[model samples]
Target chain A: MTIRYPNGKLYTPHTSVQKTEKKSKSKDLSFSNRGKTLEDEINEANDYYIKRRLAIIHKKPVPVQIVKVEYPSRSAAVIREAYFRTPSTTDYNGVWNGHYIDFDAKETASKTSFPLKNIHEHQMTHMQQVTEQNGVAFIIVRFSAFERYFIVPYEVLQKAWQAMENGNRKSIPFSTIEEEAYEIPTSYYPRIDYLPIIQQLIVEKCCGFESEEK
Target chain B: MTIRYPNGKLYTPHTSVQKTEKKSKSKDLSFSNRGKTLEDEINEANDYYIKRRLAIIHKKPVPVQIVKVEYPSRSAAVIREAYFRTPSTTDYNGVWNGHYIDFDAKETASKTSFPLKNIHEHQMTHMQQVTEQNGVAFIIVRFSAFERYFIVPYEVLQKAWQAMENGNRKSIPFSTIEEEAYEIPTSYYPRIDYLPIIQQLIVEKCCGFESEEK
Candidate 1:
């Protein structure tokens, strides 16, 4: 099956499904089975969280401008022509423990640094707005080559973004990410369990007062 | 121009633009100027709120399942085949003063009651989940025939929905809505102006603790 990305890129999956099945026979968490994209893993984790009644996070649908659509019957309508529209907000957002949570997932092949270009201007502005509203805003960055994931807070990201605008480095160094962001350990059930870290940040931000769990 | 709704319905403007232009000459807020749909007014209200930095709300895009695409160039990709997917969540969601706000906009032509059939089962389930997380959930019901708008809390909606599920009335009486829901006055700018009502809800739900204004 051909998967359409938000950027209009078509991704053809490698024989990873068969490979995953073969690896499942061993009944072990094989590193080779980690071929899923950052978005896919986050979506899977969101489903897990929803089922466990932990949080309600969802990825916003890809925006498309439909030029023409054909309705064969009252029920089925087929889109004949459409174009992708640039998203105004981040990919994922929802409520967690009465706090609004918003973030975008990004993955970089480079092991040394994550490029600032990976983040868009509008997304930065959206995150800024979210933080201003006292909502939790951050980006989940995956260093794909090293198989490392970090949740970089909006404040930290904004600082680096402003620095870049002021003729500084165009990328956030891996060392800076390691120091500034909260690293999420790889897991099986939820894939990337970042909510616990968010809960901690919420407590810290709220002056150490923890919200009651439902 | 044809506008595509989330349910794949096509909307053709009925010369409302020319009518609006003519109404502008009157230099008064005429009732004729209120021809815009509920969705359009809410989107306009959201834009107004965003500009004033009062809140950050957005309508989720229409979900589409793309089947075939043609890459004419590196920058341009045309979707050749696609189908609308059923939305799992409410249309609008965002944050206001640290509170997660989620709601759907519905319009009713019936002057007596708002039909329960207007809302889907998944939407009710989604709103339940949202409220479970202590997030604000509601429906903005527009009585088009009466030119009245009301913000109905999810708790009230769920009660009516449950009654319908138990083989009671399949519609919510307009009188019940008038008594239970908060009515929003029509305004020129920020057509719906729902954030203030949401703020009041936040205060009431938070046990009279008002969130600080930024």
Candidate 2:
């Protein structure tokens, strides 16, 4: 079967399957039936947040090093030759209510627990440094199978990391996380509605339990 | 006169002057006195700072939306076609003493001042949002010709934006910026030691001058 590009006419049998598959994909898309990828949903949610002037969170731009440029005319400069560079932080970062907020979102199919291995060493180090500098660092983990979400604090992840290093399980037990971190209630209003957890974190910080997990 | 692809080889009856130019360029290509390009120098500085655990700054990845992929083998995926995406933030971001630092480095040939047109409206807005969220937002303005530098605070630039709104000057005057912003001295070690300015900002913020920056 020959596949055709979306820009091209999909007259081939292979292209029809993908079109048919995308049509039925709406029902199986997300926890709330949002027909979009996780990145798309988050970007939309971020836009929603930004429009209301609620918070100024944004996904950063990718870095590029232009090796060669083509000046087709004075009107345009095209980077004909360019290279990619490694990213240092989570996919998203910004500020909320006079607090620096940094987070990474990950989705896992496992129903039981999210894998600790999904977090990278460099990212882990980054979170640690953020917390040290007084920024709020978190991981928004979606257990896609269960449609459950949890805002895992950097410290909680660090503790679990230590445990993992000591020959403990490679995943955080659901019970420990439930007892410590805030379980974000998924809703249609804000979709993620993570700001409430940030509010709680702020309150706790003001109360002098700044470093406490919960 | 003509210049072609692969390596831009200039063949011209323009002059033997072109010959001297190529020879001088090849001679200067050796790492004796003059070093790497601006991007390379910044990368080196980033590495220098990161090794000391001083900062987590990194250039963002090049944005490429892959359209067509060729899988010669199941294990190997090659992106055959892609389109670049516009960058949202400056090149570098990281955790600096708990402040989420976001900034872009830019240079121009103009001897008087850098052009405001070099920055996009979206980028300016993004930086403002970062400031409202309490992150340190600024730009590294390099007058590369003179080898002079200044860290232009987001607020200062924002004011310039507002001024332009009222039919005032479109660009911030070089004299005004040189007087207002902290002038960074070029050095032999670590190259761009922007940490000094950051330290000053930290000290000021720590000294109960937080609300005033707004």
Candidate 3:
């Protein structure tokens, strides 16, 4: 089958399908109605939200270090060599109702716990900084086997990160995620609708230190 | 001489330098101090501000379309083929004192007027949307020949854009820019100190429409 990108360019079949088919075939079937991955669903949701003027969120472009370029023509320059950059910030960020929202999306096949390995220390540090700056920050995790999506607020993630640093469990347990995070339901358009949960978080935060202090 | 990147990787001399030198040797020398362009100055300023915790600003990564990737090792991925992706939004954006700031940095050799071609229509539309959302949106224009920098607010740019569509002049005159824009002074560490002018713009904007109404 010929797969075409949004730019109308033909695209090769994704490599992950071949790598994970044996291990994750059932897991993939359980979560995605089509063959769309969690990232693809979130991207679609962002597009829907933007078209409706609901938010101005965008997935940041993947950073790459260009080592060589070939200028075939006056206007056409192609990067002949480059390396994938390790990002310091989250994958997504934007303004929503005058509030800065920053977050990363990750999918784990593990049903028992969401592994800390899915996130980087630098990303957590970035989230902490964003939170300190009065911005909304969180991670959207997908339990692919169970088809569950959760918005784990930075405050909760911070505590977990600190606990890990103190030599506690490296991964947050599934029960803990269920208890602390806001679960988002799947839909046709805006598949992983997360803004309502974000609004709830903002409202709770705005209520001062009463709850946090408790 | 071996060109070293910030990441300490050997970098080929940029092709644009070679091309631009032929067309604009004198123009290039007029603006850049110690081989630093306006963009480099702005980047340095951003780094300075970040270190001071004054603001969180980042230049959006140059988007790229990866056509082929070669994983030489388990951890290292090299992009074998890629194309520089065209961007739809402005170059710089981030949160500043609980405000979402978005803008583009443009340099023009022309001393008489800043050409409309320097700013893309899509970028102007994006700026308009950002302005409507109460986010700070503007353009930083560097007049290379004159060694002048101006922050042209979205309000002025929007009007100019509309006027251009209605058969007005295709560029904003330097005299007009000098009259209507905020001039940002250069400093040692933060070469293009723009946030102070941003704060001023915010203060003026918050005065309940008296000036704008006038």
lDDT leader: 1
Listed per model in order, the count of residue pairs whose N, CA or C atoms clash below 3 Å is 0, 6, 0
Model 3 off-target regions past 4 Å? A1-33, A209-214, B1-32, B73-75, B209-214
Candidate scoring better on lDDT of 2 and 3: 3
Query: What pairs collide in candidate 2?
Result: A62-B61, A63-B60, A63-B61, A63-B62, A133-B97, A133-B98
RMSD of each: 10.6, 11.6, 9.2
* Model 1 residue A58 lDDT score: 97
Model 2 lDDT per residue over B23-58, tens place: 322323543223334555567677887778787677
TM-score of each: 0.83, 0.76, 0.83
DockQ of 2: 0.26
lDDT of 1 at B183: 84
Candidate with the greatest DockQ versus the true structure: 1
Clashing pairs in 1: none
User: Would candidate 3 be rated incorrect, acceptable, medium or high by CAPRI criteria?
Assistant: medium
True contacts kept of 1: 0.86
Candidate 3 on A170-206: residue-level lDDT in tens?
Answer: 8899999988888886554556788888887787778
lDDT of 3 by residue, B28-96 (tens): 434424366777778888888777777778888899999999988666888989999878789888877
Model 1 interface Cα RMSD in Å: 0.5
